[model samples]
Target: MTRRVPARDVVVFTRLFATMIGAGLPLVQSLNILGRQTEHRGFRRVIRGMVRDVESGETLSGAMGRHRRVFSELSVSMVAAGEAAGALDTILGRLADFLEQHGALARKVRAALIYPAMIFAVTVPAVAILLVFVIPTFESMFASAGVPLPAPTRLVIAASAVVQGYWWALLGAVPLPALAVRRALGTSRGRLFMDRLMLSVPILGGLLRRAAVSRFTRTLGTLVASGVSILQGLEVTARTAGNRVIHDAVMSSRAAIERGETIARPLEESGVFTPMVVRMVEVGEQTGALDEMLTRVADFYEQEVDTALEALIAMVEPAMIVVLGVVVGGMIVAMYLPIFEMITAV
Candidate 1:
């Protein structure tokens, strides 16, 4: 069965689950209520399906597990742990909070990029106008006055000619390269290479790594606290970490754990986890408070991700400003040069 959890359904379902559990309603009643209240056809169908599954005596986790597309592994594992431990309500609450926080982080990243994107959108047309419309006016005057065009003006005019004449070609050319790049990057080998490349990038790479670590630790911690075994938790965590590099490391760590090694050892050996993380995990393993320690690690790294995102935005803003200035300023200067020379020659 195709996994079919629309985004709206997940958000609504989790929140409704949290409320119903908090209200002490029976599970089946809650799901039925949600199914009736849901506006989205897809979400309504999912809820109805879950209700039917529950009516048949299937555990909520087991039912959700069947819809792997809608419910993430992390979510399912946590639900399963919650069911086993009789803490399903608490787990539902936590799941809701986690989803909200994750959504907030996504929004922050998008908001941070908006300024530069707007600048680029505004500047591209400004530059194009100067080159195609403004520069040509200057060039025409220079030609009528029999003035010798400077190399800069000549280069600008030539660029403007190409842009004006092949504007449709220019528009069509962008999608070809984009599609080719997308196709190339979509392959497994290409994705692996890209993941490595991204992790090696300076600021963005660090941010991504931290985000992955935070997610991994948080999910594992939640699962362990809810009574999932380390092996099962690791399997779920690896597949849901969202970064292929971290996912591979988690899988490797799981294999090592299954072979009778402690979880911390495999993680340390993987080199994906930092020393600080490994030391924390080791201490957590020793003290039987691994879940608490992992939660702390997740909290600490979430802050780090926030800080890194802020810094990245700060760095990118100035870089984008300089680029916009250079592109627009160069075009204007190129157009004005010939006009200045003509005035002086008169």
Candidate 2:
């Protein structure tokens, strides 16, 4: 079985391959040098296999094609175009830059979510412990004192009893929803509905839309600049779009272009591309610089994603803190109220 290479490793491999090839090293010799230097055992094996294939007279793109787990369709297509144009080193350099940019975008999105995720992880268990163990002890003290409990205190004690009685079911509740959602996403209709819903969500929806557009434009532009035809580039970009809505829009646009329609019109009709993007694409088509125009569009949207995510993080942190304070503080106050009343009577 072919090993799956990490995105970082692929970027590094592309950069090194481009440098060695630019320095006039033969393809097989370059592969040999990379293979020996690769620290990852599985990746080292993959490089050795590519070296063997190159020594057997297969093209570099052809050898890379056999390892579909490691090299994406975009990578294979770009490499093939480069080989045909005798500009393999230049294409490899572009490929490395593209991969690095994609990875950085993912990292930024992940970083924005990490703090909220950590808060939830810690908060959930702390709340659960209060419900299961701490509240019951207070319930017994109130019971022995024969004190009339407030509604809120009685409600909390009832919740504690239910949690203690059904601990196993409560545990399953956490993972079962996740499992169901995973199963749902495996279906076509579910994925389409979910992707559409994602685009309609407030705040995060705009961020996701801009990120998707940035990825779509950057990928198609890079492919076009590398000598891939418009139709083929769209086909490859759609498959890698990560969102079904964006994928469908690209496919529709590709079909329209096949019938001699301009790219902007179909995309605009699909309602996926913004007016600015549509206008830019129109200008690019008229000026014979569609690839360059798409690159500029991608750059603009990438900055939009960055700004949108920063705003989201700023808003979400305070919102989550407010929620945590209300829930936990409310519980603490509820538990202390009866004790305060008893002391006042004495």
Candidate 3:
């Protein structure tokens, strides 16, 4: 019965917790204050439970581990590392920063797609209304006038008749494909295939790749900076990676590192990381600055994602408008051709 907390809310909570702890407030006291102030009932319940557990002598990270639905593996691992190092405030601050940056990236992507999605949402139903109602009325008028309909007009009317006849099937068609896709993604192979396919998609593929790399590097770097071992960091990063391809690549790299192979070499072999990233990682390893280098890579790719999203939005907005216009205009032209021809004859 627990509600899913939004990433933004989690980020805010983490920031406030870090600030309160840094200001010398006790952990239990901070949780109590935050829990009372939390507007989300589910999140409040989670906070209160953590408070009770903390008061019962459980470590903060251990208490959070019990609510895996709210606190991710990354969060728990970071907190555990913080507690071990006696730098819980610093780790919580870093966690908050990571969450905020990740949420910002997601928001940008969603924002870029919003206009095109809205256009399609409005256009589809408008076209359907024309097809289902408006076109049929015109067809009856033409039929009663005993006028021979033009080929285009006849085609449109036939389409309208089909739509009217198969309305239920048409409605079912929407969710059935989505349900099938959801089911497919539930399987490991299906998820891997889809993730690979996503990387090959035109325009969006590059964006997705950069975004995935940004996420991978950022998560790994943050974990490493917070004192998580490379292997453990990679494992956590892989598990949380939204794309299967990235996840597999990180796991492969982790396995290689376990065998004493360099991280860069395995990542390069995985074909997910760019040559620049590989070279940077190699240099970082040699200089003992792997965490710093990874952080740099994350920063670069996050900027790249921003630029790519902007370019994509600019291209998609016009393209969607043109497509919508062409579809609706074509149908209108098709329906009106017979009426125009009859008027011209008279």
Best by lDDT: 3
Tens-digit lDDT track of model 3 for 1-346: 6789988889999999999999999999999999999999999999999999999999999999999989999999999999999999999999999999999999998899789889999998998999988998998898899888878888888889999999899888989889988998999999999999999999899999999999999999999999999999999999999999989888988999899998888788878789999999899889999989999999999999999999999899899989998889989998888888889999
lDDT of 1 at 294: 96
Instruction: Encode model 2's per-residue lDDT on 67-114: one tens digit a residue.
Output: 988999999999998999999999999999899999999999999999
Q: Per-model C-alpha lDDT, please? A: 0.83, 0.91, 0.93
Give the Å error, residue 129, model 1. 3.1
Query: How many steric clashes does model 2 contain?
Result: 0
Best by TM-score: 3
Order candidates by TM-score, high to low. 3, 2, 1
lDDT of 1 by residue, 1-346 (tens): 4445556568667987988988899999888888888777776777788888988989998998877777888888888878887888888888877787677777777898899899989998897888778877877877888878788878888998899899999989979988876786788777667777888898888888888888899888887887889989898888777766787888887888779777887787766789999999989989999999999999999999889988988999999999998888877787788778767977
Residue range with the least summed lDDT across 10 consecutive positions in model 1? 1-10
Residue 309's lDDT within candidate 3 is 94
TM-score of 1: 0.90
TM-scores of all models? 0.90, 0.97, 0.97
